[model samples]
Target: MESPIYLDNNATTPLAAEVVDAMAEAMRAGYANPASQHEAGRRARRVVEAARERIVELLGGQTGGRQPDRLIFTSGGTEANNLAMFGLARMAEDRYDGPHHLIASPVEHPSVARAADALACENWQVDHLEVDAQGVVELASLENLITDRTRLVTTMWGNNETGVLQPVAPLASLAASRGAMLHTDAVQAVGKIDVHFGNSQASSLAFTAHKFHGPLGIGGLLVRGDTQLAPQLFGGFQQAGLRPGTESVVLVAGLRTALELWHTERSARLQHLTSLRDRFEQQICAELPCAQVVAAGAERLPHTSNIAFRGVDRQALFLALDMAEVACSTGSACASGSSEPSGVLLAMGCSDEVVRGSLRFSFGAQTTPPEVAEAARRISKACKHLERQKHR
Candidate 1:
């Protein structure tokens, strides 16, 4: 049997060969607790510190200030986002006089949205900033929403489902002007796009290794110089007590290797993925003339394309594609198993018909033109078959 074309890279990517090898070596050699004061522990501590410095270098070095920034490793992007969102909000609670406020875009990942909800329950004013038809948030409205009490503004750098790039930089500047801290969830943007901590004014940013061909269960939140982040986890002196835990030396090694590869080959990878995405979109659009590419007018990730096929049930079409050995998704991987349409699309004012019919196809660094062409062929055939059955 032929291998299936894997196009659902937006959900997660397969680990790179170099990343796996580095992880194996770290597991064998640096297998002691980093906090231990003995020789073996000191060696492990050195490995952990080296990994942290490599990550900082990947994020464009510590150019924001004289002091080096802080990167706290967590279970993954979810924990990193929670630490940035919940941790900062709690810090604001301790500093401010009366009811503090938080802001987030409507199309944020569940991690950010749910964290905002938790803050709202504590009597904090949480506003879901509005987005336009292309899923880009309204900047003018965001300015109007800011008040003196607004403590932090949380937004994702790139949308997970639509792949639309948000106005994170301008938002950060706006938040800074209002004396409010900014935090961006850059999980989907870090390795796939040009995300640099030095260039951004955000007080904190989060990312995960698994999103970029590294090991899962390892991610970090970069806290800018002197950012006040209250401890999210409690136990020992790890990560300044911000995210206390015995660091995974092997996972950190994998992350460092993956990031180094991405940093060095970013330009070539972007061009390659962009070409594949354009060709794939052209093929699918030619085969299905009635289909609409979500956020086509907006700047999107080079590897991601969300297509909405009118008059087709996405669940049925997805199953058909799966049977044909094609892989795709209806929305965010974290929101899988839900019968409901995407809130992101609904927020963009898409009708129920369009919302239920959309599917995400994301490419990877290793995806080839032949694989994309074959996947498009299979998808076109499956969609045609589904449409005929519905007409019958």
Candidate 2:
């Protein structure tokens, strides 16, 4: 039997060899809790802080002087996004009067979308910016959406389902002009794109290491200088008392090693992933004319390809591909097993058939040309098999 092909990288990436090795070494040398008071703790604290400070620099943020951007570590992107939604909103609660206003997109990940829903439940005026058929949010709606009461504007930098890149910089600039801050969920965008936080002008950004070939359970929220964030979790003085907890030096080591490895070959990785994705998509479409790539007109992440099969059921094709050992997805991994059509696609005005037939195939750093070619053939075969079965 041939080796299996794995292309569901947008869900989560396998840890890099260097990241795993660094994490192992950190467990041996810096296993002490960062919050402890002794020398061992200080060593652990140094390890954690090193990752944090480097993240600020890697993401094109500032440090030192009167005010510097801060990176607050968290469990992952979910927690960081929740913190940004709740922390920033409440941070200005005491000083500002009247109902809080927030602007978000209908296509945000469950974390940000649910956070917005939670805020709406609290009597806050939450308005969602509409998205086009390609899953790109309307920038025109934003200028009108911002009023005197608007506090924060939130959107994802790269969509997980369609892989479409959002207009974040211009959105951030528009939001800033209205005295509102922008918070981008850069979980999928950070490693795949040239995401410069300072140049973007977003007040806060959320990202996790697992999305970028690093370990799970560790991520950071970069908050711009002069932007005050209220504490989301209450505990000790760790992470400037914002997300207080005992830091994981081992995981931080994995994150540090992962970022360093990407910096070594960012451009090459981007070009490689783009080439692989294009090859795969072209092969898929040519072999099966029934297939159409979603958001084909929009700029997308290099590693992701969401394609819709015209007359096939997504779940049926997904199961067939899985049995064929070709890994893929119907939509966001977070919303798996729900049996419902993708909300992201629905918000983009995709028809019931298009939404039901879409499958997301995301390549990774380790994906090879042979694997992509084989996977494309396998997918084509699976769809044809399902088509024959339906007729029978």
Candidate 3:
């Protein structure tokens, strides 16, 4: 029997062979706690430090120059984002003047959007940036929303569902002019597209290895070296007490290997993913007239595709695809199992029908043309049947 075609790369990716090998090597070496004074502990610490430096360099973060960036390890994107928001906010507490304000697009990941909600509950003024019909965040809205009181601006670089690329660089500049730090959840963008921390000017950036064919349970938050982030978790002085906890040497090894693979094959991977995505969308639209690709006009990640099949319920389509041995999603993996419509689509002002009918299909670096073709056929068949039943 054939295995189910996995099209949910944005949610998570399968571990790569190189990453598995690196992890196994780390375990075989029996790395000790990085905090200890022994030579073995120092060896483990060196691995973590090397991985940190390499990750920053691979992502185009500042390295040799003044104010080089720092990478803070976390459990995943959620913890990293939380550390960015609450940590930055707390650090800036001594400088707070009036009602502290924050700016974010409603299309942010659950981690960010919910963090904004928590801030709002504590009397912080929160403002949302507007996006267009294609789900691109309007820079003009940021100009109007960002004020002197705004301490932070949060946005996702590449949206997980629609894959719309935000105007993050220009937005960061605008926020900087207002003395507001910018944070971007670059989880979906890091492996799919070229991301430069220095060029992006995002005060802090979050990414997870699992989203890029590495191990789970480990992620990084890149921030300026000069940035003073208050520690959220209190304990020993590991990670400068910012994210104080024992680091996972094996997971770091896996992440380092996975990122090394991407650095070597970045261009090839992009081209392949673009080809697969284009082929998948073409196949779906050719046979299913009601299926419209969402945000196709916007600059997007090569791996993600969101389709809205008119008159077809998203849940029914999802179940049908599951039964047909194809895997996809409605929106962010962190927000899975909710019956609510996609917050991203809703933020883009999609119609009720469009929001109700949309599904996300994200390709992986390992996804092949044949899998895309077959997945498209299965999706077209499922949506066509569901649409017909709806009409009946």
Q: Rate the local accuracy (lDDT) of all candidates.
A: 0.89, 0.90, 0.90
What TM-score would every model get versus the actual structure?
A: 0.98, 0.98, 0.98
**Can you write out model 2's per-residue Cα lDDT over 243-360, one digit (the tens) per residue?**
9888888888888888888888899999999999999999999999889999999999999999999899999999988889988988888888789888899999998878889999
**Clashing residue pairs, backbone N/CA/C < 3 A, model 1:** none
- Give the Cα RMSD of candidate 3: 1.1
Per-residue lDDT for 172-286 in model 3, tens only?
9999999989999999998778999989988999999999999999999999877778888997899888889999999999988988999899999999999999999998989
TM-score, prediction 2: 0.98
Instruction: Please provide, for model 1 over 301-330, each residue's C-alpha lDDT reduced to its tens digit, 9 standing for 90 to 100.
Output: 898899999888899988888887778898
What is the clash count of model 1? 0
lDDT-better candidate, 1 vs 2: 2
Model 1 score (lDDT): 0.89
Worst 10 residues of 3 by lDDT: 90-99
